[model samples]
Target: MPYINIKITREGVTAEQKARLIAGATQLLVDVLGKNPATTVVVIDEVDTDNWGIAGEQVTRRRERGR
Candidate 1:
């Protein structure tokens, strides 16, 4: 079994895109490692901009600055 965790900023990701991500991740494991799709686990975590930070600033502020 393979466990994969994917984290992304919750800005404008659509359900279709997320579905593609899950499917693609599962297929990657199946194609590259011969893992069973049924046994593969993929979890997507969306973090709020306020909760995510980088370069000593929150993601919300960074986006506001447009840098």
Candidate 2:
């Protein structure tokens, strides 16, 4: 089994983004990694803003408020 794991920021995450991510990942696995797209598995994880930070600043609270 070919497993693909993806992690993205909580901001601006959408279904179309997820689909495009999956498609691009699948293509990379097939074309570059030489994996079979048929047997490949893709997993996308939307990480909480607080769970990540930039410039040592937390954005979890901001993300929750926006939601």
Question: How well does each candidate superpose onto the true structure, as a TM-score?
Answer: 0.91, 0.73
By lDDT, the best candidate is 1
In order, candidate lDDTs are: 0.94, 0.81
Residue-wise C-alpha lDDT for candidate 1, range 1-67, written one tens digit per residue: 8999999989999999999999999999999999999989999999999999888889999999896
User: Residue by residue across 1-67, what tens digits does model 2's lDDT show?
Assistant: 5898987776677899888999999999888878888888899887777787766666776556673
RMSD versus native structure for model 2: 3.8
What's the true lDDT of residue 18 in model 2?
87
Candidate 1: C-alpha RMSD to true structure equals 0.9
**Which whole-number lDDT from 0 to 100 does residue 66 have in model 1?**
90
User: With candidate 2 superimposed using the best TM-score fit, by how many Å does residue 65's alpha carbon deviate from the native?
Assistant: 16
In candidate 1 the C-alpha lDDT for residue 14 amounts to 94
